[model samples]
Target: MTEKDFVPKKYSEIIEQGTVSWQAPSNIALVKYWGKKEHQIPANPSVSFTLKNCRTITKLDFSKKDGQEDFEFEVFFEGNKKEDFKPKIRTFFERIVQYSPFLKDYQFEIHSENTFPHSSGIASSASGMSALALCVMSLEKKLNPEMSEDFFRKKASFLARLGSGSACRSIEGDLVVWGKHKEIKDSSDLFGVNYADEVHDNFKNFQDTILLVDKGRKEVSSSVGHNLMHGHSFAEARFAQANDNLAKLKPIFAEGDLTKFIEIVESEALTLHSMMMSSRPYFMLMKPNTLEIIIKIWGFRKQTGLPVSFTLDAGANVHVLYPEKDKVKIFEFIKNELVAYCENGHYICDSVGSGAKQLSEEN
Candidate 1:
C-alpha cells in the first residue's frame, strides 16, 4: 500500500481521556537494510527475525488539550524524566501528524521502559518507537471504531518507520520484510509485511544470544552511514546483492537449509561492516573482542558441525543466531568459551517472537 492509504478518515467518536499501552519487540535482520532514501525508504529489501525477550513497553496517556497550538507531550524513560528524548519524539509527531491529525487534539504523556540496559549496544529505537506507534494507533482506534486490524497494524508500522526505519519490522512476528521487492507480495517501502510463505519447522523458535562486546555508543550513527551511501562507490552493487540474497533466502527458508542460511546470514553481517569501512570517512564498529567472539564461534561450529552463526548491528555487540535444537550446545559454548569476550561477561538470550501486543490496564 502507498503512504496515502494510511491517511485516516474523520473520526466518528472522540476519546478525550484514556490510556493505551503496548509492548513491541526488537528484531535482528537476516538480510540487512543499510541505506535509505528520503522519507526513510530502504535502499534494498531486508527481512528480520523478531525477538521475544528484548523489548520496550510503552504506555501513552492522553487527555483533551488545553489551548495548545502545537503537539504537546511529555516523556519518561524507565521511571525517570528524560528531557533529551523529547526532541526525537517531537519530530516523530510532526512527521505523523498528517496521517493521524487527531494527535493535535490531545495532550499525551508517554511512559516508556526497555527490558535491556539503556546503553547495552542494542538499538532501543526499534522497539521503543514501535511500542509508541502502536500506542498512538490504539488511540486512533478509539476514535475510529470501525478500523480493521490489518489497517491498524500497517499504519502503526508506517508511522514507526518515520521514527526509526527498522522499527517497521518490529510490529510483526517470526519473520518480517520491509522495503518493496518484486518477489515479496504486498511488500511496500512504507511499512513491513509478514513473511507469509511456508517456513520450515527448523527455523521455529530460533535463538539469538547477544554478547555485549562494548556498551558504548558507536562513533557514527546509522543516519550518517545511510547518507554516506548517497555517493558510495559500491552502493549500487551492495543494494543489488541484498536483493539477490533475499531471493536466495526464499528457498532456504522454505527448505530449512541450515548451511545456506548460515552462509547468507554471516556474509550479510560482514558485508554490512565492509561497507562502513569502505566509506569515504572510514570507521569500524566492531571491537577486537568482537572478532575474538566470531573466531571462537567459527571454531565451535566447525568442531561440533553445528550451524552457529553471528550477525552484527551498527555497534560492537554480537548477535549469535542458531536453531533451537542446537540451543543446549550453543548456549553452553557461548557461556564457556565466548562470554570471555563480552564486557563484564554481559549477554542476553532471546528467541523468535510472535510480535507486539497491547497491554490491559492491569498489566
Candidate 2:
C-alpha cells in the first residue's frame, strides 16, 4: 500500500503506547464563577478564556510493575517541589479513578508543573486540572481507541470538578460556560461549549489584563468564602442579585455591546464581593494597594470615558478588560498609577484563545 493509503491498525501502535502528556493554559473569568451550592459547583454559570503564557504541563506514564497497580503523583509550583500539594494530588487521582473505573488497575506516574506563581490569582486551578483531565483522557484513548473525544472531554471535566470547581470550564474553548444547567450532579449535564457558539457573540473585542498587586496566598478559599456567604444574613439578597445579574448579562453579552457588558460585569463583581463582606466574620481580599490601583483605573476611565471595566476573583489581583486595540493606552495608565502601590505587581495581557487540544502523540 502507498504511504497515503497506509494506516495503523492498532491503537497501541498509533498512540506509541507509552507516556501521555498534555498542557493547558490558565484562564481568568470575564464572568466569575463564585460560590458553589453542591461541592463548590458555582452559583451562576461563568465564562473564561484559555490564557497563553500561564499554563500547566502534565505528563502521565502507565506501566505495570510487579503485577500491581502503583500510582505516583508530584506537583511543582513555579519550578519548586510542593510537598503540601500532595493531599490535593492524591484526591484528584482518586476522583479520576472513581469516574473512569477502567483506570483503577493501572500503574501510573503523573507529574505536573505550572508556569506562573502559584498564589498570583492566575486561576492555577483552571490550567492545572484542565491539563490533568486532558492527560487522563489521552490515556483512556490509548486504552480504548473506540472512545470518542467528546465522551472523554465530558467525563474528564466531571472528574476534574472533584478536584476544583473552575477546572470544568478549562476543558473547553476560549470562552467556556459552566454550571448553566441546574442538574450539575448529573455528570451528563456538566459539559462545556466553545466560546464561538454564539453564546457570547456580543462582546467579541474583549481582552483581559491581570495586575498582580499581591502574590501572597489567599486567606479564604473559595469553599470557605462560599460557606461564609451561605450563612451570612444577606445570603438571600446576594443570591437574588446573582440571579438578576446572570439574566441581564446574558442578553448584554449576546448583543456584543461593550458598554452594557462593562456595566453589568463591574456591578456583578461588586455585588458578589459585598456578600463576602457581609459574612459574620467580615474580611476583604483587596489590599490598600489593590484598592489604589482600582481607584486609579476608575479615575482614568472617568477622564477618558472609556468603556473599560475591572473585576476580581476571590483574590487580590485585578482583571481589567477592554478592547484589544486600546490595550496600549490602558497598559500605560495602569503601569504609571499602580507602580507606587504595588512593588512586586506585574501585568499579564491575554486574549481569548482556542481550548484544550492534543499537543503530541504522547498527549
Candidate 3:
C-alpha cells in the first residue's frame, strides 16, 4: 500500500501545525473473537466491556508537509523512541489514508504510553491503535467540520479494525459488539457498535481486576494464533459455538442473569485457550499459574455465592470479573489467594469505562 492508492474526493490544505491527543481503553471480550478473515474482519462476533483504567494515551504533533507525500511519522512510548511500532502504524495509515486523508497532508510526531504494562498481554494494540485512530479521526473532523460525531467514530472504529481486529471494540463505550451477527442491529464485520443500551444496568459497570500471571510477552503473537485456526478441525465448530453463546448472552445480559453470564464467560475463556491447545501446530500461552488462578476463582465462587467469574485474553493474565457490589469480597479473596499466583504480586484494578476522550486543541 502507498500514497498512490489513497485519492480522497476532496483534500483540504493544512492551515497550520497542531497536536491531537486521544486516550482509549483496552477491552476484555465476554464472547471472544479468536479468528479473522482478510483485512481484519472478525470470523465470529464478540462482545466486550471498555475498561476504565487500562488505556493508551497518544499525542500526535502534526506539521504541514513540504509536498505531496505519504505519512512520515516517528513514535515514542514513555518518552523514548519506539521505532518498532512505526511499521505497523505506517501500514495502518496506508490502509486508512482514504478515510483520513489529513494523515498524508502532515508529518506526525506521535508519543504514546499505556496506564497498564504492555507486556501484561492484555491487547495494548486495542488501546494504542484505537487512540491513534481517534487522533486521526479528530484531525479529519477538524478539516471536515461538517462531518457528524457518528461518522467520526465510525470511521475511527473502521480504521482501528484495519490495525487490530479487537481495536474496533475499543472505539465504543461499556458493552460493545463486533462482527456481523444476525440478531445484533448495526453489527458489522468492519467495526464495532456500542451495546450498552441493549443490556441491563448490571453489566454496565462490572469490575475487571486483571491478575498478571506473566508480565512478559507471549511466545506466540495473536496473529500467529489466529492463523493456526485456518486448518484446525475444530475451527468451524468453535465459530458456531461462539455464535450460540452470543445468542444466549443477549437475553442474559438484558435480564441480569449473573449465573448464566458467569457460565458463558468462563466457558468462552477456556474455549479460547482450548482452540490454541487443539490447533494444528499446538502451542500454549497460559502459564502454570494461570490454571492455578482459574481453579481458585472457581473454588471461591462455589464457597461463596458471589457472582464472580474469570476470563483470559490471548495471554497468561486472568481478568477476574465481578459486579461492583462484590468489590470488597472479591478483592479480599484476591489479596488472600490470588496475588501469590501473580508474577511480581501485581494486578490492575479496572472497571467498565465511558470510552475515549480527546484533549484540548493545541496550535
lDDT of each: 0.93, 0.66, 0.87
Best by lDDT: 1
lDDT head-to-head 1 vs 2, winner: 1
lDDT of 3: 0.87
Please give each candidate's TM-score. Answer: 0.98, 0.85, 0.95
Task: Check candidate 3 and list the clashing pairs.
Answer: none
lDDT of 2 by residue, 245-297 (tens): 65565566666777787777777667667767778787788777778777887
* Candidate 3: worst-modelled 10 consecutive residues by lDDT: 1-10
Question: How would you encode candidate 1's per-residue C-alpha lDDT over 1-363 as one tens digit per residue?
Answer: 777888886889966798889999999999999999999999999999999999999999999876758998899999998999999999999999999888889998899999999888899999999999999899888888799999999999999999999999999998999999899889989999999988999999999999999998788999899898888989999999999999999999999999999999999999999999999998889999999999998998899899999999888999999999988988999999999999998999999999999995321
lDDT digits (tens) for residues 226-306 of candidate 3: 999898889999999999999899999889999999999999999999999999889899999999999998899999999
* Per-residue lDDT of 280 in model 2: 73
RMSD of candidate 3 to true structure, Å: 2.7
Residue pairs of candidate 1 with colliding backbone atoms: none
